[model samples]
Target: MDIQQQLINAGQYLKANQLAWGTSGNLSARLDDHHALITASGTYMANLKEDDFVTFNLQTGTYEGTRKASKETPFHTGIYRVRQDAKAILHSSPFYTTLFACSSETIISELFIETMYYLEDIAYVDYYHPGTQELGDAIAEKANEANIIMMKNHGVVVFDDSISEALMRIETLEMACRMILKAKECGIKLNLIPQEVVTSFLEDSKYKPRKKKGENFQR
Candidate 1:
């Protein structure tokens, strides 16, 4: 509804958490069924405003707004195309997610319950040059399994209906990554929670939306 305000809030949160610096991160919120408002390319996260966001058509998938959408938009668009439930997407290069992102394997959390609840498992899509079809395809494949994904050697990407929830997911992911890094300092094996526990936790809390697909925006 209020896309600009949403951008402002997300930008502020990014600044407060140090998740982004200069013009490094981007965020987007669905404007209607067929359109989303995304941060324009090259906009600094520390001082972002509503006007800094641009509109992109969902079906045709083009930004018609005065300002250009983020260059990494294909990454965001790929997720949106695959996840009908996702209303907001956030892309950031936080220190730890970036650290784990560069790993050969996909990062999974055995450390935090929040990680289990927010993201059953984090997916890792191997490096593909940004804004490319290959990257989008790899990312979309992962989107089917999880909402939070670590782009190989890139950063982290998150999707959820509410921008607030998506932002929280990013925070949780960073915290878990930080803990893993800290524990590694002691040479102790990280005790990750079992898959059974994560499954049970998800069963305990489930959301059945009244409307799975909102009205698709049209030209």
Candidate 2:
């Protein structure tokens, strides 16, 4: 399937996975050198389809099949503006993350290896009005430095080079958030991975792709 169709499927999957509730999340992908296909404003994610996706000019943030576009369009625009590597962005207000936002908790990847891959730490950006330049600037300032950013009293924004990657980051962040909550609930300390393990894992991982190069290319 084409990217538009894949994007639409991801929209459905977002709702199916309970990552978004009601009218609260936005998604977009780089359509080309200059445009993206994004979800429209106020559309129920549960009922989304490819037709619900709108083509937008990245330079102008103009949506062709407008349903007013997402209220958080600037946030997505901000991501692309800052990170040339970011091809898609997934922004969602999740339950645990919202709770963390309420308590002003900074996200730390304590228990999960998945989150460690995407977010060494998920930074919290100060509150800004949705869809405004303030919101854009706040996220833009930190997005390049962190893959996952949780907005103050708002939601979580994950930036990546593909829709799949963004979605996976969101899921991993949510899992970390939930685990944090569960630990609080049970009155047990979160078991953080040892630094040595984390360092070893990352070091070994970095060389995997290149390890095949010596034999495969034979230059």
Candidate 3:
């Protein structure tokens, strides 16, 4: 599918799954090294159209289209610039994910293999006013450390070489957060998988074919 359609579908999917509430989130994809396609400011993710997106130059912050880019556009562009392997980014304030973000809890448990692999070493960014250059700079500093970035008291920024991979990790992160909460409620103390086991999984050859290209590239 085309990049536009992929974004549209992603918005719809995120909305339907309750990952994006109100107009509190943004999504973007790199058009090239210098430009990106991002959702417009205040556009509802569930009701997106082609015109709801703006193509903006990363270097100059100039937008070609009539619509204004999302206020969080700087962070999106900043991430793409720093992380060349990042082809798409999904920034949303999901209930469970944001819940974990607000707390001191970390999403480092390896309750599932998918969580261990997809969300390896989730990074944290301290709270900064939304849409500010400070937040953008914070993201840039942490972009190279992990694929999923948890903005303290805000939301999360997830990126990957493809929209599919990015979305997969987004869903997985949310689900993992929910599971963590549920386990706590049930009085089940969660134990992270052993470090040795995690190391082995990381070095496992079975997942080589399924892994996306540029999955390990850092800024």
| Highest lDDT against the true fold, candidate | 3
> Which pairs, if any, clash in model 3?
none
For candidate 1, write residues 1-219 as lDDT tens digits: 466887787888888887776787788887777888889999988788767988888778689868888888887787787788888998889988788887763455656667666755566777898778788778877786677878878898988889888888898888887777777788878777787876666566454222222233221
Residues 123-148, candidate 3: write the lDDT tens digits: 89999999999999998888878878
Q: Let me know the TM-score candidate 2 reaches against the reference structure.
A: 0.88
TM-score of each: 0.86, 0.88, 0.93
Sorted by TM-score (best first), the order is 3, 2, 1
Q: Rank the candidates by lDDT, best first.
A: 3, 1, 2
User: In model 1, which regions exceed 4 Å deviation?
Assistant: 205-219
Candidate 3 similarity to native, TM-score? 0.93
Candidate 3 wrong stretches, greater than 4 Å: 208-219
Candidate 1 weakest ten by summed lDDT:
210-219
lDDT of 2 by residue, 133-174 (tens): 899888887775677788888888887777887788888877
What TM-score should be assigned to candidate 1?
0.86
